[model samples]
Target: MTNAVTFKILEDIARDLSSDEITFPTFLDITFQVRSALKDPNLSVEQLAKLVGAEPLMSAKIIRMSNSVALNPSGREIADVKSAIVRVGMEAVRTVSFAVAMEQLLKSKQMQPFENLSQRLWEHTSHVAALCRVLARKLAKINGDEAMFSGLVHDLGVFYLMSRAANFPELVNDKAELHALLVGWHDNIGHALLSALGSPESVLEAVRDHETDREISTVSNLSDVLYVANKIANRSSCWRDPELDGAVDTSVLDTLFDAETLAEIIDESEEEVQSLKAALGG
Candidate 1:
């Protein structure tokens, strides 16, 4: 969807989301916990380890990556959850948190009219988050950690749009119309939603103005980073949209699109995604 339509949805759903407690799906509990853990670096390694193990899927990933060749130390062996969590750093835990939370967020609620929308949303969200992290790091000199969070949460407006769309299927089922509306309005919705969530100025700005830049000065900002990251994420996905591709500048993006760098990011992101997918035990 375009920024305009996205923003409008955000405005419409303003009454629905209460940031005070940050209501989320049951599946999001672990994600919230992990995010909390990330903020508290002093959290006991053993306690955090136990916390990670509390979720079998995330626990396995912690162990797998800790022992993998990518982070190969002289004799790094993650025998248990605690070792895995400590070795990977707290923020890494947050990534798993997002995946787990998102999984739960997508679980179909009996009352929700959009039967399978949540599931599809999360699948798309997770891939977007991964792509954002990779693309931002590659195209701009953006930090991976920031990219992780921005990519993960950038589409809160879309969530609201989808939920609302359930009540108005005719308005949403059409791609062209929805995309046009979104481009013109999502930024506003994103801006408001992010503001409600107490996001940083940088994040809020990025949420609002990510689609296009009025001046060259703002291009170096996180908003631009996410804007571009969003495009890259979409490109990396199976649900390819030709319309979305037209919004980006090929020449500028070409310099940043290096095969070697993309390969490295893809390799790591794939490993993480696969590991998480495995943890689901499918």
Candidate 2:
């Protein structure tokens, strides 16, 4: 927890980043397969369904997401993976794959030591993702699914760092010290990790700049939507501990939307957000 230890941890991460040797959990195997499958333009719905069905948990989450209010506004429901895939689309299925992977990673024995932090991080991730979807659709006029995916993975670096921190018992037990290290390194680490994962350029850009403050009169791009969404979500972040962390400043939102409009958006999206969060296993 001392400065020397923090420097050493940062150095270790930097070495991994430079060498492109960042490690991912075993649970991400399914997620990688799903993403790889989705990249094939010739992949049929049935084929994707078959692939998804191979992983029972991912398949179940896909079906649940397809039935969520965010994706399925109608009351009608479908009971099969194929139907679910058709309803949610390929991108959404990819998002669900990540949702399932992260959920599993948190439950994995390796991450058990940081269960509390993992849960908090997941909750914050869900909130930001839901907000991104809503904000993208209602304000940015961008693809809601893409925005949601960006939000979900924006803090991916933090998760990876926590996983790595499992090797450092002292760091694991010191919440304040752990939080400081994560804040200092997550953004750059996330960008590198996403790049290594072959994430879309737009998504990589959003992740890289989500924490960077900038003046914007409106939400016009994915980065803008993510920035606004991240700020808003941080108002009640999982990383927040009054005794360990300081209050998050969201005043930049005032430059984008008036108080009434922002409140209205939050109010209207509350139900959908919660629904999507639950669908994502929040």
Q: Considering every candidate listed, which one attains the maximal lDDT?
A: 2
lDDT of each residue in 211-258, candidate 1, tens digit only: 564433232556666765565455544222455425334233445546
Task: Give the runs in model 1 whose Cα sits over 4 Å from its true position.
Answer: 1-12, 17-27, 36-42, 64-79, 107-124, 135-142, 163-199, 213-221, 238-282
Per-candidate local distance difference test: 0.57, 0.85
Off by over 4 Å in 2: 20-23
Per-model TM-score versus the true fold? 0.62, 0.93
Measured with C-alpha atoms, the lDDT of residue 5 in candidate 1 is 53
lDDT of 2 by residue, 1-282 (tens): 366677787888778767846555566677788888988989999899999899888888888888899988987897899999989888888888888888888888888988877888898999999999999999999999999999999998888788778787888877788888888789888898778778999999999998887788878999999999999888766565656767777889887778998899899999999989988883
